[model samples]
Target chain A: MADLIALDDARDERLRDYTDLRDVQLRTTVEQERGIYIAEGEKVIHRAVAAGHTPKSLLLAPRWLDNLSDVLEATDAPAYVLTEKAIEQVTGFHVHRGALAAMQRPQEREPREVLAAARRVLVAEDLVDHTNIGAIMRNAAALGFDAVLLSPRCADPLYRRSIKVAMGAVFSLPWARLDDWYGAPALLRELGFTTYAMTLADDAVSLEDVEPAERAAVIVGSEGPGLTEHWQREADHRVIIPMAAGIDSLNVAASTAIACWHFSRR
Target chain B: MADLIALDDARDERLRDYTDLRDVQLRTTVEQERGIYIAEGEKVIHRAVAAGHTPKSLLLAPRWLDNLSDVLEATDAPAYVLTEKAIEQVTGFHVHRGALAAMQRPQEREPREVLAAARRVLVAEDLVDHTNIGAIMRNAAALGFDAVLLSPRCADPLYRRSIKVAMGAVFSLPWARLDDWYGAPALLRELGFTTYAMTLADDAVSLEDVEPAERAAVIVGSEGPGLTEHWQREADHRVIIPMAAGIDSLNVAASTAIACWHFSRR
Candidate 1:
């Protein structure tokens, strides 16, 4: 049961979690420091609740209250009701979906725990775009990758934009950040997974030519510079997706999708 | 040689092509009605020029002039020089790319002509998002697809955001809008292409199970609602990428990338 608080002012101090969301730098810092992330829209809010996340609070227009009544009933968090215009003023964007929840960010998971039961996993090294991270998470989950590991520099998968782009795939997919990025490849190898570093090096074998392994992990890199040389050198093997001449490469998300689909167990 | 004219005012009538670019409705209507499209940044501008698109005019900062000097020598279009702040004011958004060009939109190519020499092609139906269309173009080109065909309602491939996201792949890729979308599937078949309609229908066959053909075309629908019933019924085969249970589907761009990579001639 939630306490339905009607808010008339967008600048209310209690609404701090939902303010300045369009400022990525401010939100990233405030969110990490406070251990909270935002779930936008009805569907994503439902997913967050189903994933066992606790809600710190919710901000919603009157129209969304009924649709989210069950979610409110499941937690004791306060639900703030605001007019659509006031909600927009608070969030700094149109609340098109008409609902949002401030969820408690779960403590970071151990990389080994995420990979313990996994047979196929994805390792993202320094991917900095929230949309790209979200898209990759959706692809990995839909394509049947068991889990994911991210280098410390990777963008937050739980960012509002990332969650929206992923359509809540980030909630269901198990992922962990690697504190020691330099040793990530060796750790996966020791856990009985063969590692494939995706790259464009001339000597790299084509993704189509690589045989499926019983337990495999694919490592992808950042947008511009791609996989750092140290990470590429440390992986067990380098794999390249064969592309048409002259065109350099596919966008990171698209390329990762192809690799995930190919490596997924039939 | 381009005529470089210095301008201090953001309200110059000559800058109509570059005004309020952040307003999608206004720009779409204006650009199409005028038979022109914008090319942003130095790289995209260069690719647009290389693809034989004549620039009507260019809006640039002094810093970008030196880098674009060669392109200037190639075009007789007048170039308007402004400060970075003025460029931002005129465009209603920060011009981080520092250059913009209003280019003459190329005449639409006939589907038959674009597909005549093609063994592989991609057909996008009603994809209204510029980013998705751009990404799909990049994937299709990198995977060696011969050309692309768009439904009449599809977003313009030459839209600035699409061109930027595609990393100028749109300039190199041959694409055209179908004047008659209802007859599109049949047209592909008539041109001797085995059409594969991407869908989530239970009766659809796995993409991996399908054999490579002499000539193939993959049809992808819009972001939501997927393929129209008409297109699905008319396609030669309904194909689906095997996905994990409980997940609906991959992003249109990602699924299309996997399809293009799989159906590409090895």
Candidate 2:
């Protein structure tokens, strides 16, 4: 049975997992050190559990405790019940969703292991925005992309903002950080994948013209400064979305979705 | 010639156009009542001017004064130069972009007029996020969509964040609101548009299977609720972006981009 503990004091040390929710820097560091991530709202918390992530603890408002009884019954983790005011005091923000779960990070998978049976993949390079990362994951999962390989500098998809924006799609998508950001292109090539760098260059083939290989990987760049020339040159093919004159490009996340749509057309 | 004025006081009443920018409700009311919208940063401000918007006034940091001299020389609007700190104090946020312009909101065009000659259009229904609206605009512009038609409850594309996120694509792309959000389908039909509501209905045709019309409009819905039943039923065709077994739909912005890319191929 799960331990249902009453949380009367917001300052309790046990509530540290939910404190300073708005402090990105503090939360990121603490989460990384503790090897855990925050899953906010009832739906997202449910998704995290479905993804097989073990919950260290769950912070729930009184009203939410019964609503998530099934979820609580499935886990042995302690559930901390707090008043709305106490949750606000602990999280440093209003608990609008009425529930939050701090989940233990699942073990990392090697890129090769993730790509072993995959056909369509998205490789994100140096993307700094968590929302964009989450959106890409959502699009990738929706459009049948098998896995996401992120450059070392990409934002954490497990972050609360990303999980919220993705509507829990991050939990369903398979993703891993690339150990060698610089060698990403060569590594994909060696793994029997044809890499297409999504870019805007004169010589790039239109998205409609490029053929997806049996095993294909589309490499997406950061929000700004696009893909560095090195990675662009490394890919076997460069494809452009063929925009109208004058307008430069689609938002990175939008581009990811369109690219996935094109690649999955087969 | 634009008049150059020095502004040291952040609390000056004349600087009201640029105050407390983080307060969306307050800013929306003020901008709407003043019959103007803000264009932030050098790039978006330049885009607004290039789109032939009339600038009511320009608030520029001293460092940005020279950078935008060509723009200033082109208008008779007063340019108020403030220190970075004063700009921050006035805007309640760091003016990292360093400039803001209060530009007259362009006169609203009728939906019929915007769609009259357009071969490709994106009809946004009840989209509430400014960033999504902006991204849709950018995608529409980049992918050669001719215009955008928004439902009544859709967010204002002229909002600063939308302008910023769209990278000022809203200035270039033609858009108008459908005063009758519920009657949008009938109006589009009367205007000779073959409407497609992007949905995930089991019987919906795959995007690849649906042929484009001579004049096509793809209708996307809100982030929360997809297209309402009434709008979906009213659409000429309901199309699905075929996905993997268990996955659902893409983000509305992502759906917009993919849909536009599909329509533009014709």
Candidate 3:
């Protein structure tokens, strides 16, 4: 059984991971420095454990103890109980989700490990929004894409918000960041992926016209700026989802989902 | 040209239309009571005016005046100029998009009018999230769906956030709320629509199996709770997107987009 400890103060040293939860800048830095990410709510906590994430500890109100006893028992991590108010003070937000788990950040996988044996893959470039990244992961998993490859600047799939927004898809989909951002298309090409850049270039062919291949990489970019000029020019094919006139684009994540679905169907 | 009026006080009565912009509940009540809705930023404002909506007035920073001179010149409604800080104080937000507009809410169209000749239609039920509602509208417009029909409880498509998220697709897509929620299925049926309720019912057919009809209504529900049981049973057909095993569902808007894309193809 895991240790069940009582915590009284919000500033307790043992609860260092739970402080200032809403300060994005501070939380991002501290989470990185400590190599930890949080899983919010009961469902996400369940997903975290099921994904083989090692929970460093858990913080919840005493009332939630029985409901989550099994989660606590699955790991040797301690469960720290506090009054709801104290938990709120520590987190700087209401603990409406019942519980939170601080888990060890999984080591980054090599791009090859993620892409090996994949038939269809999503290549994301510098997607800055955590929600968009998470939604894209969920779409990738739902559509049965084999792998995900991210440019070095892409949002962290395991960021707390990303994981939550993805409904824990970050845990299920195999993803890795490219160490060589400049040579991503070349790397995918060498790995036998027919790289298709999703863009609005004038000469781009309709998404329906692109032939899905034995190994395919559907490359997408940030919402506003879109794929950098260098990457767009590097792709094997330029593809556009034929849209109704007068609209420039769909939300990045939505477009990615549609493209993935089309490629999977083909 | 719009009456060029400069206003310095955040508390001025003339700016009431733009006050407390971030308070959803208050804005919802006041907007409904006054028969008005706010359009945020230059693009949305332009779309609103272009949709034949009459502007009551506009609030913008002095710096944005020249950028929107043509838009202001197109309407006789007064334009109020305030310092960015004053605008922020009035709206409780930075007004970072350069302006906000108070426009007369277009009268709800008859469901028949929206469905008149639309071969593809989207029906939204109690979608409480404005962003989801807006995205659904964008998808409908982009996928070439003829119109949208909303449940009585749906978030307003013209809500500031919804307008912003839809990128003004709300103005282009004709939509109406069902006055008779309990009998909406019957109403659609009476109008010769082959109504398909998108649900997770165990016996539901795969979305691909449903035959696209000359007149179709693909109905979706709220983000979290989804369609009520009664409505689910009332539809002529129950359909589901074929998701990979172990996933619950996609975001409502994403699913709607895919479904629209499918129906349009057929």
Candidate 4:
């Protein structure tokens, strides 16, 4: 059981981790330097606990502590109980969810190792938006994609906003960054995987037409300049989702979800 | 040709529609009262103009006016050319996109009309997030979904934020609100459409097992508290996208895209 500590002062030193959250640079720098990230809301905190992430401490309103007694019992971290007003004052915003947890960032496994045992994987290239990156991971986790591989330009999945947007699935999903897009396809092929690059080209094969294989990698690119020509040329197959007359393409995240679901079905 | 009206004064009464935009209440009131919306970026502006939306006016930096000669040639509305500094002062933010357009809201078609000629339609119930609403429209347009039907609780599709996030596809896609959910499904059935409701129940049929039909309606609910029990019971088919071991469901927009593509393929 976790120790419950009562905090009356909004400026307590122990609450430094939850302060000045609106400043992106300061928050990200703190995360990188201290190797910790904050997870907000009761649902996400519960997911983090279920995924076996160790919580350094939990900040919650007294009302939430009383309401979420069962959840508090499952974790061994100290709980800092404060008034709703005090909690809001420290966080620089109204966190209506009432409960938050600061947890250590767990080390991730290499992409090759994750792919070695995977049947279906999602490869994201230069997806710079953190929310999109998080949504892709959430969709991948929900649709049975075994893992996600990110190119060098992808946003940090552990960023505060990404974790919040992902609903904590980022903590459970297997992800790693690949430094070299030029050589990554060769490594995937060596691992018995067929690569499919998603594109909007007229000549590209329909996603439904691709035959199921034992292992496959679905490659998605950034929003504007989709998959680069170099990567598309090297892909084992280029697949397109047939669109309506006036529409050109779906958002990258939406397209990725459709492609992932199709791959999962196969 | 659009009359190039160079305005040096930030307080020009003619620019009232584009002033103090950072005020949320004022913007929302204008949206509700005037029923007008703003579209940003050169590409979206071009698409909106091409879609026959009458431009009320165009606000552009002096540097961008030179590049917009072709666009100006097609419209007779006054184009207010301002310096970058003046543009920022008027809009209450840095105007990096260099161009913006104000458009009068076009009249909407009835939901029944949009569905009558459609082979496939998406019914969104109580999805209030503007971004999700926009993304869903973008996906529906791209995946060949014929039209969209929104329940009364859904957000306004013509809202400014939704228009921007949708990349102007909202103007091209056909959509309307359905005041009656119960009667609507029955109407759809009478029209020879198979209604499929997405749910997370264990007994629901896998999406892969849903046979293709000539006419189909895929119903989706808000992020949490998925399809209402009434919708689930009323639907002709309950389809589940097979997920991984521990995950629950995909994001609403992501799931909608997958379902739309599946229906289009069939």
> Candidate 3 lDDT, tens digit per residue, B1-266?
99989999999999999999999999999998999999888878877888889899999999989878988888899999999999999999887886988999989899888888888889999898898999899888988888999988899888888988898999988888888889888888888999989987778998767788889999998767878998788988899877778876789878887888778777
Per-residue error for B142 in candidate 1, Å, reads 0.6
TM-score of 4: 0.89
- lDDT per residue as tens, model 3, A1-266: 77999989889999999898888878878888899999998889888888888999999888888878888877788989999899999999897976988999888889999888899999999998888999999998988888899887777788888998788889988999888999888889898999999987768988767789888999998878888999788988889877788876788878887888788777
Fill in the DockQ of model 2.
Answer: 0.81
Would you list the rank order by lDDT, best first?
1, 2, 3, 4
Q: In model 2, which residue pairs have backbone atoms overlapping below 3 Å?
A: none
The alpha-carbon deviation from the true structure for residue A124 of candidate 2, after best TM-score superposition, in angstroms, is 1.3
In candidate 4, the residue pairs with backbone N, CA or C atoms under 3 Å apart (3 or more residues apart, or in different chains) clash, namely: none
What DockQ does each prediction reach against the true complex?
A: 0.84, 0.81, 0.65, 0.76
Candidate 4 regions exceeding 4 Å error are A1-15, A67-90, A179-182, B1-13, B19-26, B70-76, B81-92, B179-182
Best candidate (score: DockQ): 1
Best by lDDT: 1
Put the candidates in TM-score order, highest first: 1, 2, 3, 4
Fraction of native contacts (fnat) of each candidate: 0.94, 0.94, 0.51, 0.94
* i-RMS for every candidate: 1.2, 1.1, 1.3, 1.2
Which wins on lDDT, candidate 2 or candidate 4?
2
Predicted candidate 4 versus true structure: per-residue lDDT over A133-229, tens digit per residue: 8999998888888889999888878887888777777978888888777798898999999999999888999888988588999999987899999
Q: Model 1 over residues B58-163: C-alpha lDDT tens digits? A: 9999999999999899889999999999999999999888999999999989888999999989999999999899999999999999999999888988898898
Tell how far residue B237 is off in model 4, in angstroms.
Answer: 2.8
Better of 3 and 4 by lDDT: 3
Q: Candidate 3 docking category?
A: medium
Task: Give DockQ: model 3.
Answer: 0.65
The docking category that best describes candidate 1 is high
